[model samples]
Target chain A: MARPDNARYQETHEWGRLEKDGTVTIGITDFAVDQLNDLTFVDLPEKGDKVTRGEAFGEIESVKAVSDLISPVSGKIVAVNDGVDGDDFSALKKDAFGAGWLIKVKPDNAKELDKAKSLADYEKQLAEEAH
Target chain B: MQETPLRAEHERLGARMVDFAGWYMPVTYTNIMEEHRRVRTKVGLFDVSHMGRYWFSGRDHIKFIDKLVTNDRAGMKPGQIRYSLMLNGQGGALDDVLVYGAGDDATMLVVNAGNRPKIWDWIQRQRKGFVVDVTDMSTDYAMIALQGPESANLLNKVSEVDTKALKYYRFTRGTVFGEPEVLVSRTGYTGEDGFELIMPQAKAAYFWRELLNVGESLGAGPAGLGARDTLRLEAGMPLYGHELEEHINPLEAGLDWAVKLEKEDFIGKDATVAIKAKGLEHRLVGLNIAGKRIPRQGQDVLRDGKKVGTIASGTKSPWLDEIIATAFVPANMAEVGMSFQLEFPGKGTRTMKPEEMRQTALVVPMPFYKRPGKK
Candidate 1:
């Protein structure tokens, strides 16, 4: 799927979207999910946990390897996605952008999202990586 | 990086290639779980050309081989294959190998890809008094494994050799897909019935494509090394660097059956006998953890809050959907139903207590998933 046009992305393939209520919704991109094929477990932070920008807040384990889920913006996690947290991964596998949002964070500073790449820039980075 | 004969075919199939033991090989075509299940229930093809294949001949072929490996070669019938471990003088394993007894004058030794150079040098150094001609034919042939429950049916459809007549651990030369002189062996690392075919390197691409073409209707597909590892782990097979290491003897690794102590003195025979007499300090045991988080290699195994063992190999089994692992613990603690704690790497120094980072691991029987109705 085309990365949602409004979402800001990190080089590590995480995407975050800013809402009118000033909370940011975060989830991993399709590319990251594809690379981590056959995911067996996903460990996410609980609600009210503090997350720092450009640091690992959780982990994702596939059949072969384990990778970190980096945060794009520092914030306190206000809500965790119960739909994709535990043994069930149907939401994350079905629509990674829409229903698969991992956490909702109330950012320390909304301007921190400015450091992330735009949708076009993220696609450009992905294109260059293909070569 | 070294390339296999079927490298181009793997690329065409959209395989995710990675550097494995200095050779560029496919890790997965689609996904590891899908390929793993395919091998368990149906059939899957694997390009194992990267492994070292050495052909031996001459007057002392059997004598030289019998003196180098742990398994008995004197009683091996023609066309039979035996799994053996080549060891150092200290009884430490050099490499686990498959000894193929072709005939009175010929033998073939297949070694792991990573240990090819070391094994080759060891053989050369050890053959001072024996008259054996060893030829390294790893690059000259392509080894393909057709594995699963439906493998025999698939082989009978494409090859002239009658799959029904081939007994387990036996090999035969036959024509496959109009390609003559193909060596078809009914042996595999997977716990299911399967065949490993050795063919000329030049015709590897043709045979790979043809096999998929004909076997596709029988639910056959291409698998990669990722699936190969999980399948072998579930089968309780000892990988070279993991379960069978340079410092780990066959007895400590639960491979006592393959080590023939009564046979004539081979390399490490004296040390092996001494080890048996001294009894085992630590023994390899299987662990079943009750969670999704896998216990990785080198992780600490604990008993009553004290570190006592280490994980050798572990995976979230695709077939059983459970976290199965192999570990080495004190021989007294290796019994089934014995429980221990597996210390997982804590997440970012957020330690609550010792018990928080540890998960309970139970000692279980090996070969966690056995193919039903097969020996």
Candidate 2:
């Protein structure tokens, strides 16, 4: 469950990385992937769908339950991961930082401080918590 | 939170522990879906040692039990076990359990782990006459459910008793793994052909390890609670806390078959009869989610725009690879091929397909499922 070098993380365990033209790629972190395993189906929003921060944009169906995929940042869905459909879901853990990227988003605020924090910062936040 | 004796073993296996009904139990080992798949495709062992055990004794034990539980204990043979529910005077379920008559004077009752204290209190209150001494022996005993495809074969390797002659729902009490163990019933909460081995606390871990070793060449693996839920869901079985609770009666939950109206008398018998005569408005039904989304407990079940029922339990079947759910709907919606929309809390609403739902789920008919034979 190690953090990848290129991706930044949200407090909600989402990882994101900005592309060349400022389009951001977003997906859940490795820790999140490990937490919700054996995903049978994913309900992602349409490519042009609008999402708000703290709102659920989709759902993930595991064996015992279906949990919501809460949006970590307000954005417009530009592209969903091509591999999320059918049975090509290897990236959810294998290359979670890259191919597992859920969608490309144009943030509501281009200059907004991304919710993603550094790896050490994320680890520190979890460490301070009372589990 | 309380810990079972197998808590150490679960932790050692890298299980993800969760707080289940005030007990710290393993929710999964690798992951719920993978564990679910493992059990369906091959074998999965489960450490269900936390479940409660009660021993009813004395000369009138059979009479006491016949008047205690909702099942028809009068006709129940010595070696046969029956799934039954202990009900309150109001017909509300106190706890569901498996009843195995060790002897006419001694009968063993395996109750849910969480409801041990409640059921014991109820038992003490009910045992007034008939010379039955109710004893709570849960702490002294441990139970292991060796479920899935290869359970019978694996048990045959170690036990002296002839398990092949032992039919389903039957048990043969004898020595097992060098312990004073009772291997009478192949009944378990999981929907599989499996045997539940009961023993004293001292010899439990050794038997569990030995079973794992015994099933090694046959591809048997230790399963967690994750797969158990999925297997039961796939077979359209009801969970106690979710589907059958203190506020829920067996009749309303579609478990009236467990309650015998022909019996002389039992706890909640009159109330069950009254409820049956007056009829029930809400009844539990199985759901096959139309879309990919799964509906979990506490979620609302809707139709058109009306609130119909609430989801009691839900899971994605690893065998079928579809979302399965149990919900208590109105009598009208309880029928097969009745389409309803479900609004999952936190997750958006999805319309359930009526034809697909009915084809996928039945009314939890008799036996529910005929488990795949191990040997």
Please report the candidate that would top lDDT against the real structure: 1
Could you tell me the lDDT of residue B1 within candidate 2?
83
For model 1, residues B19-48, the per-residue Cα lDDT tens digits are 899899999999999999999999999999
Residue range B219-272, candidate 2, lDDT tens digits: 777777777877776766777899899888898887877899899999889998
The reply for model 1, stretches above 4 Å from the true place, is A114-131, B345-357
DockQ of each: 0.33, 0.35
Which window of 10 residues has the lowest lDDT sum in candidate 1 chain A? A84-93
DockQ of 2: 0.35
Q: Model 2 residue B188 lDDT? A: 69
lDDT of 1 by residue, A1-131 (tens): 76798999999999999999999999998887877777887777778889999998887778787788889999999988888774577788788899988988999998899899999999999888654
Count of steric clashes across candidates, in order: 0, 5
Instruction: Give the docking tier of candidate 1.
Output: acceptable
lDDT of each: 0.90, 0.74
